[model samples]
Target: MAAYTVPKAFPTTVVGSYPKLPSAQEALRRQRKGEISEDEFKRLVREAIRGVIEDYIWAGVDILSDGEQSREDMVVYFAERLRGYAPGEWVRIFDNVYFRKPIIVGRVEWVSPMALDDWEYARSVSGGRPVKVILTGPYTMLEWSFDLHYGDRREAILDLARAIRREVDEYLARGAKYVQIDEPALSTRPWREEAELAGEALEVIFRGVSAKRIVHICFGRIERILPYILDYPVDQFDLEFKNSNFRLLPYLKEYGYDKELGYGVIDVHSLQVESVEEVKKAIDYLMKLDIIGPEKIYIDPDCGLKRLPRRIAREKLRNMVEAAKLARKEWAGEE
Candidate 1:
């Protein structure tokens, strides 16, 4: 694997998902209720994915994805595909959102390649732009699922690390340039011991694969994980700063974080779209920090746009790209 380089300063991208088309969402519900055939559900999912990819291209996003339209939830999607996991009762994650929690009934195993086809399809439709292959990290997958089989949590996480690595290897073999491991649960861990264990699990997952490794951790006070997380073997850290009002930047600078930074300038949790100027302001503030250089910065939304309206997600991405262009010009001293 070659060194991953940023194409340009403030290159705009997304954090994996775009809002699912309403029809696609309905197809998911119908499929779950057995009201629709599996073939019918997959056809609608493909259509939704293609439309989302088109939106990304139209919005001028620098890096693209398949919008994760085929997935209901990140962890559960993989759980459904991987062996040794059984769906339990629906559990509430937040207000009005629920998922069937996964229970580990046996040793976790990777029966086949997951997301490789999705990556291939996304790359085919990307108009030659790099498409990021995203997956739920081992630590997050283990943390999110109930461990009824593995007696020790550490053992379970490590097993998951091995299982997910197989999927990563397949993605690389199929020509994925960038791969992001979504580990949002890392920040919210109740104990530092768990965080340490999670770090070890990351090493197991990331050791030697090497294709521009990125870890996206969001929605929690990252200050807790800090310099420890910086030690993880990854090229770049994709994180949420907009939702936290860029509070982590000071900590990052204080801790002397030296890796490439994926800065989030748009808040995905809100319906209100950020203006071009507002987005530019966020980027400008980070540029002035001097800790992360312009060449190392990649701009994106705070997190996935799955909860927001589809039109709003598209508009937000357009604003993000426009902001990046203006920021690039300013950094390059162009009028």
Candidate 2:
């Protein structure tokens, strides 16, 4: 069981939102309209990223993320940013959900160290509160992207992991303390034959990142695969809580896991802001178990705040942060 330690000050973070630039909306519209070139869209995305970082910093968030506003698609853009990858045609996940695929045309090559200036921008925003850097996990990146070169997904994931590891080192060298690797696809249900293969990919992807890592297992059936991740050496597990997967909390107890849990107390999927009382209720639900502690827990929304309007997102985060403060005070029996 994990021990409790109330943070001196409430520590709050989001999966990745706050740095998306305003041009994001227009860029999306243009991309859908097929009116802009890929290169132009990427430039606009960079601008939107700058805007997101500025907005989040001004909003008083303790830990800020790049908001990932500029990339045409989250996983695909990572491919476009790399040197040895080719932008493949667009593919749909289900119905209307579409993303570009980066085809692995050649062996991975690094022309320059991959870095997003979101952390530096956030430091300027918080006057320095340790910006939380966000990236797509190598496993998710490989699975999400089109790989034409390698037959073995493990090799592809490991290669991608090594490239991203270099990027992580660069980000940490630039002073990033908290790095979030988003593996949303981990929740998808694939055939049983693919499970071990997926696990292998996951193992290779996380091989060399630092100790302060957050593996975001959003958008998937976490209960079935929590065991695979429980064995990994990540520090925090950021999963969806505002939505109905509260069943997984008990699974943490069942597994006797002891990492810090980031609970999504507010509903970021909607415009409605969660009340401080609601936030308390969420934490109280988790605190009922002795496996995790209040201090080891971080409060947040269900996921990224990108789709939310600026005012609504701000209000939602403000209430969530305030709720964390209130919860901390109450938990400590402080006035």
Candidate 3:
């Protein structure tokens, strides 16, 4: 078990990305067009992150991220920084939405700390709150991109894992106590080899980090990888629960999974915000299931809130926080 202890149990957090402020969106547009100086762009991004952090605090989140204002896209952000990638053609991730795919063209290397500046600035302004740094894990980076070099997939994956390890080390060295490695791609291909490769990659990235080591995998065949990931070195598994109506609970119960469970109480993909009572009821149900106890539960949204409107995101988070409070009150006797 990890030495890290929660500030408060059932702590509220996010799945890493939150909506960018309108001003920050505009700044990204201008920066891409070279209409603003690099320093000016950095300033705007910091302010945007501050705004999101303020929102999180107001919503009563116990753990916070920078809202990832500095990233355009999760995979793209890391691809742009690492030495091996080049931008490829656009590819559709959803029905109509598309993003430029990254192609590996040379040796993959973590030249420097990609998120140090953003993390340092965010921590400085977080008002004593613990700030977490989120990174796109190696397996996802490999699965999401095109590899024109490093003909062997395992070689490329391990190289990317090394890069992530270095970045995680940087965050730890810089006082970050929480780091979440997002590997949403683990479920994309439900093959044993795929899961095994991801496991090996996670092992490399997760070694020697004493902080709250978290791995987040969502929106896929979670059951397929459950057996493999249950043994992963991370202290917690932050997964999508609400989105799947907690379908995997049975698997977790049957396996007697024993780790911190980042319960997804809010559905970020929905426009209608969850009511506090509704969220509390969901927790009530989870408790009755007796799969995992309240001590190991960490409340959060199903996924990133970047897709939802800012107002809805705030309301959803507020409700999630309220639900956690209400649950704590009901379970007060246990303490």
Candidate 4:
């Protein structure tokens, strides 16, 4: 998304946020309680990032991430860093799961780069592979947070977009080649209503920042956003095909969604590690659909692997890399 080169066919990557190492998680918890110094916590997180980068390189992934080891949660992490926001009461995100959702206390602004150090650290350890910076999209950030300051949703979302664009611009200026904005809310309920706002926000974030910009939307009603989503200002639309049993593939094909795809070949929500055969089959189905080719796809999990155990996530990535290689060979008639 710095000096772009054509990736190998079926380039294996991730949607970011791998399962945190036990030591890193413990360090975070201790830091929260003031039992560990900030410097110590950061050292642990950097170690975790190095470990993650090694795993991806060893597993043969083409594109990689910092694995978001330092992040507490996607939305909360960015919210805490940005100006004019504060943590609100604990709120449930899923069944029996709660997070400290932020409330917008004033006009949102970006005071500094939120993900630069980690991205640069990952790059140093990534064996020269492309490491993407994953930022929570402005729309998602606005949607997840309580808007006490800006009563108008458009005003709040656009302002957040302006804030995130600065982060994106910084990454581009600093030589980041890939950047992804996670916007699961784009496919959530009332998605039709939010599509226009999301588009406008995307416009701001990507206005002039040119990298391999990606928009990842998973685990929601993707079918509803079809043709409309095809127009968002991103180079790729990373969606969940494995989670929906590839049911959404037909729509993308039907809508002629013609951009690079971050293909979901692994299911992260499931504890069972996907066999290489399963991952290959998923890739084959997309190829069979004939809407896009291997060169235009990035083999990946349905979403971030934070929900799985660390071992399970690693195994899943291993299988994914194997599957992508297998698919690549077959596509080339090398096997």
Candidate 5:
């Protein structure tokens, strides 16, 4: 168990996804339709991932991911690897986006490592940059799935928590310094009981894992559960801000948010690339608040950029990195 460290202030990163290339998407379609061999599809996917790594490097992003190129859907990808789960019908998450919801048919179990190979490949291509390993948290996994075996939701979530814990342990053993657990459903839980259970499950998931733990929540107001969630054992809270026009910062300041902040400075749902000036303005706004200093801040997009065009995604990241560098200078009184 070692502590995670960042090299400098306002480090630029992404919230773990890049847009899939059209050729990769077509290859996936062909593989699903049985039009191409599995080996061929995988070769195309590996090539696509290399291109994505290059995109991040070119954009000057300090932290990188595998771009999730091998994954069709976040929750379903892990469900397919774990035991006692089967893919169900497509369920709409939002506009034009859908995933085949997973159905839990029996006791959940971790059969083997799920994202290790992807993380290894990402590290190999990162050119010594720290690759952030992102995982869909247990609570989100259970919430998005149809649980038939564990009739009780709390029981099911805890079981999934243990399964995810195993995966996190494996990542830590393989030299992962930063591991993020995405639990967007934490913001949408309708009941206090569910929220409490989610917090407990998060504790279970990160138990005994020493990597820098981050939890990403997006697309919903977090003021209601921020108090409860802050108690979870994590090193940073990656949140959406640009989409809400920085409305949440004041609330976080008032509540005395003490953990490291993954400040989202770009909106991912839109194709319009934010100018460097716009991003700098957003960073300036946060700095003026004085709630968290530059050392505690991380700059990134509001969410994964998989929905946008590849060109737009790259441009957005490039601007974000530039803005962060400019802000870093201002923080040091160099500007």
Candidate 6:
């Protein structure tokens, strides 16, 4: 209903949060059953990651990930891999639904392989299109885990920020030119009382991580907290557009903020494939806005595609890439 106000440019790209393949899932299951040694597990994981990398490339996805499918869940996997962080208990959000929780046991520390392996696998698969190094944002870790540390939540966040900062530095030095810090929960807070808190906390964690920093917020209304997300000093803001928050684009553009936007057009949750026409309509709506355009926009699904059926996910992504090409043709007056 409102006008989109972001700029547009050539060379739009699409990315989604898709999972790894069947082999990776099988290896994880076997390892959990104690049928494989740690070394063997790592070897399997490496092979699985390579597979994911290759698949994304073949699918024409400009950006690639290790699929993150074998990692025992992103946050918990990192908690187990890092020193001074341990699985504590499970926490419930809705009835009978819970996330495996971790606690900060001491000063945060990152063990290798978790960070190193991700970087290396990306390098092995990347044909120089700039693979994104995905890491859980500090705020997200604090939100998902038990915060029984030496001080208040803010204090714990700063500590985590420092630890994440170290990880970012290491990854960057190892040929990681693009990085994604996932903070899907930050937008769920009461924005009025915590805008500065969220903004400042992200400010600290994002400091010194120069490589195309993208803070991803989706699958929730955290839309009400866009003021905070917009305030943070980062390169891009990736948010859900096909889902409920599609209405937020006008407000984002109205504020005259100039950061790049990962404008999600495909619905990741639906098995019903999105038509190229639907994606085009969404893009057309945004393009009509004064602030939004090709240069400032990147196409994506409403959220990660990991939960959807692999076939559906791949189709949605394929449609998205084609949709981008179509948008380019129409925008250039070639269609």
Model 2, stretches more than 4 Å misplaced?
1-10, 23-59, 93-97, 189-211
Compose the digit string of candidate 5's lDDT tens values, residues 1-335.
23324447998888987888765787778977989986787777778778899999899898888888878888988999999898788989897878899999999999999878778887888788888989998889988899889999888888898999889888888888889999888888746676789889889978777888899998787777777777778889999999988889888888898889999989998889999999999999998998888888999999999989899999999999998889989884533
Candidate 2 at 31: error in angstroms? 10
Better of 2 and 5 by TM-score: 5
Q: Estimate each model's TM-score.
A: 0.94, 0.83, 0.95, 0.95, 0.94, 0.88
Q: Where is model 2 poorest over a 10-residue stretch in terms of lDDT?
A: 1-10
Candidate 4 structure, TM-score to reference: 0.95
Cα RMSD (angstroms) for every candidate in the order listed:
2.7, 4.9, 2.8, 2.1, 2.7, 5.3
2 against 6, candidate with superior lDDT:
6
- lDDT string for model 4 (184-241, tens) is 8888854665888898899999887668889999988889977677788889989888
lDDT of each: 0.85, 0.69, 0.86, 0.86, 0.86, 0.70
Poorly placed runs, candidate 3 (over 4 Å): 1-7, 333-335
Candidate 1 per-residue lDDT over residues 1-335, each given as its tens digit:
33333356777789998898866798788988999887788778777877888999889898888888878899899999999999977889999999888888999989998777667777777778788999998888887888899989888988898898888888878767788989999888736787788788778767887688899999997888886777888889999999999999999889998898889888999999999999999988887888877778889998899999988988999999998889989985532
lDDT of 2 at 108: 67
lDDT minimum window of 10 residues, candidate 4: 1-10
What is the number of backbone collisions in each predicted candidate, taken in the order shown?
A: 0, 6, 0, 5, 0, 13
Model 6, CA-based lDDT:
0.70
Task: Please list the residue runs of candidate 5 whose C-alpha ends up more than 4 Å from where it truly belongs after superposition.
Answer: 1-7, 35-39, 333-335
Q: 1 or 4: which has the higher TM-score? A: 4
- The lDDT, on a scale of 0 to 1, for candidate 5 is 0.86
Model 2 compared with the native: what TM-score?
A: 0.83
